[model samples]
Target chain A: EPEVTQTPSHQVTQMGQEVILRCVPISNHLYFYWYRQILGQKVEFLVSFYNNEISEKSEIFDDQFSVERPDGSNFTLKIRSTKLEDSAMYFCASSEARGAGEKLFFGSGTQLSVL
Target chain B: AQTVTQSQPEMSVQEAETVTLSCTYDTSESNYYLFWYKQPPSRQMILVIRQEAYKQQNATENRFSVNFQKAAKSFSLKISDSQLGDTAMYFCAFMVNYQLIWGAGTKLIIKP
Candidate 1:
């Protein structure tokens, strides 16, 4: 079975620096999402993308954050200025459709460490 | 706002035994979706099972099953014949109006 893939499984960056976490969602998926989980905490939704536009975003997804498909197969989340609070496991997920019962397939996650 | 709650923070069960994890949610929407995701040490969120609000019958997959009570806003997962591989952090999530609400998760340990 095909799975979502994320690159640079672990990222270390200084505060106030820019960082882009990349994801290659399932080849046939139509909806993409980004979620963050602080160590030992609940996973919080960041943003959702579809049809080349942001379908929805949580309050945590502020002006400093942005997402782009950039290409047919890649979805990237960019944080303009990283903060210590930004350290977390970022997961990228995709679904064939946004149906009520459809389950999103998730990547292994990129552990971002903001120093 | 929709909120999912998993009251149990951690639990342990012997292999070959059964374990049930509880979950509850607060939602105003009549139609929505519920899911159980298991994340092992790898931290990859794997879909274990799903339940739709309108469905009367519970969703089941192999040893994993759900007991969904929409009226009570409760959805629980029961794992039968639990194995070592079943040990993981289990999260209960709610989907409504295109938003996914996640619970804190219950850390389940399967002892040999």
Candidate 2:
């Protein structure tokens, strides 16, 4: 089965540094998303991208965060300034459609550690 | 506002036995989607099963089945003949208004 792929399974960076996480969604998927799970916390949606722009974003997705599908296949999330609280497993997901019950395929996740 | 809740934080079951994971949600939308996702130690989110709120019948996929009580606002997963591989963190999610609300998750341990 086709799967979403993410680069740099793990990343370690100092607070106040910039970090970018990359994901390659399934080729045919139209909707892409980014979710983060803090240690021992529920997964939280950061943003959803469609047609090269953001369709929706959560309150947690503030000014310091940005997402870009630079290419037809590559979706990236950039954190302008990392904080210790930003340490979490960031997962990239993609779905084939936009309607209700659209099942998503998720990547193994990028573990971001801020020191 | 909508929310998904999994009351049990941990559960254990013997291999080849059966187990059930409970999930409840608060939603006012008449048409929505409910789903169960499994996350192993690898941290990969795996789609386990899905149930549409309008459907009266339960959804099943092989050994994985869901008892969805829309009026009761409850959805539970029943794993039959559970295997060691079934051990994972299970999350119940409610899909509404273009957002997916997730539960804290229940950690299932399959004893061998």
Candidate 3:
């Protein structure tokens, strides 16, 4: 089965530093999303991308966060300046389309630790 | 906005026994999708089962099944003859308006 793949399985960055998390969604998927989970917390949606633009974003996806489909197969999330609270597991997911019952395939996730 | 709730924070069942995890959601949309995902120690998200709100019949995958009550806004997962590998954290989620909303999650332990 085809699955979403993410690069940099684990990353450690200092406060005020920048970090980029990359994902390669399933080839045929049309919708891509970024979600984060703080330790012992719920999985929170950060942003959703479709048609080369952001479709929707949550409050957690603030000014410092940006997502790009930089290439045909690469989707990336960049944080301008990482904060200590930004430490968490970032997951990339993709769905075939906007169908009513479509399911998302998620990557193993990148563990970001900010010091 | 849609919200998913998994009331049970933690639960445990003996191997070979049955276990049920409860989930509820608040949504006004007539058409949506519900899903149950499992995260083991590896922290990789795995789809367990899914149900379309428009369908009345429950969805089942082998030993895993769901009881989806659209009227009550309830969706529960049942694991039959559980095995040690079934131990993991389970999350109930809903898809609405092209967005995914997830619950806090329920930690399940299958004791040998």
Candidate 4:
């Protein structure tokens, strides 16, 4: 079974620093997404990308955040300036289609800690 | 606004027993998809089961099954012959358009 892989399983940075989280989606997947889960909270959608551009984003995804599929296989999320509230487990997910019924495959998650 | 609710915050069951996790959602759209995702300590989201609103027949996968009540807006997951591996935080999600609206989640503990 193909899986989504995220590098730097854990990341630590100062509150004002910049951070980039990387994800390699499944080879055949066409749609990609970024989600975050604060400790002890429900998962929140951040952004979804397809065809090398953003399809939709949540209010939580603001000017400070951006996503790029710089290549055919790698999707990355960059935070221009991280805040303490940005500390959370960031998850990368991908699916073969954008249908409501399509199941997404998620990565193990990158735990980002903004000190 | 659409919301998914998992009333139970946590539950525990002895191994080999059957356990049920409750979920409900509020939505006006007639067509949508409901899903159960399991997250163990690894924090990986794994799909457990899915139900389509238009399908009257419930969806089942091995020992995992769902009792989906479309009119009532209820979708519950039932784990039969539960094992310790089945222990995890389960999230119920409602898929509309291309996005998934998630519930807070229910933490399930399977004790040996």
Number of the predicted model whose DockQ against the real structure is largest: 2
- Give the root-mean-square deviation of each candidate in angstroms: 1.0, 0.9, 1.5, 1.0
Tens-place lDDT per residue, model 4, A18-110, is 999999999999999999999878788999999988999999999999999888889999999999999999999999999989999999999
Tens digits of per-residue lDDT, candidate 2, A9-74, equal 999999999999999999999999999999988899999999999999999999999999998899
Tell me how each candidate scores on DockQ against the true complex: 0.79, 0.87, 0.69, 0.83
- In CAPRI terms, model 1 is classed as medium
CA shift at B43, candidate 3, in angstroms?
A: 1.7
How well does candidate 3 score on lDDT at residue A93? 93
**Clashing pairs in model 3, backbone N/Cα/C closer than 3 A:** none
lDDT of 1: 0.94
Better of 3 and 4 by TM-score: 4
Candidate 2: clashing pairs of residues: none
lDDT of 1 by residue, A1-115 (tens): 9999998899999999999999999999999999999997789999999999999999999999999999999999999999999999999999999876778999999999999
lDDT per residue for candidate 4 within B1-112, as digits (tens), equals 8999999999999999999999999999989999999999988899999999999999999999999998899999999999999999999998886888999999999999
Q: Give the proportion of true interface contacts each model preserves, from 0 to 1.
A: 0.82, 0.89, 0.58, 0.80
Predicted model with the maximum TM-score: 2
Name the better of 1 and 3 by TM-score.
1
Q: Give the per-residue lDDT digits (tens) of candidate 3, residues B35-101.
A: 9999898777889999999999999999999999999999999999999999999999998767778
Clashes of each: 0, 0, 0, 0
- C-alpha RMSD over true interface residues, model 1: 1.1
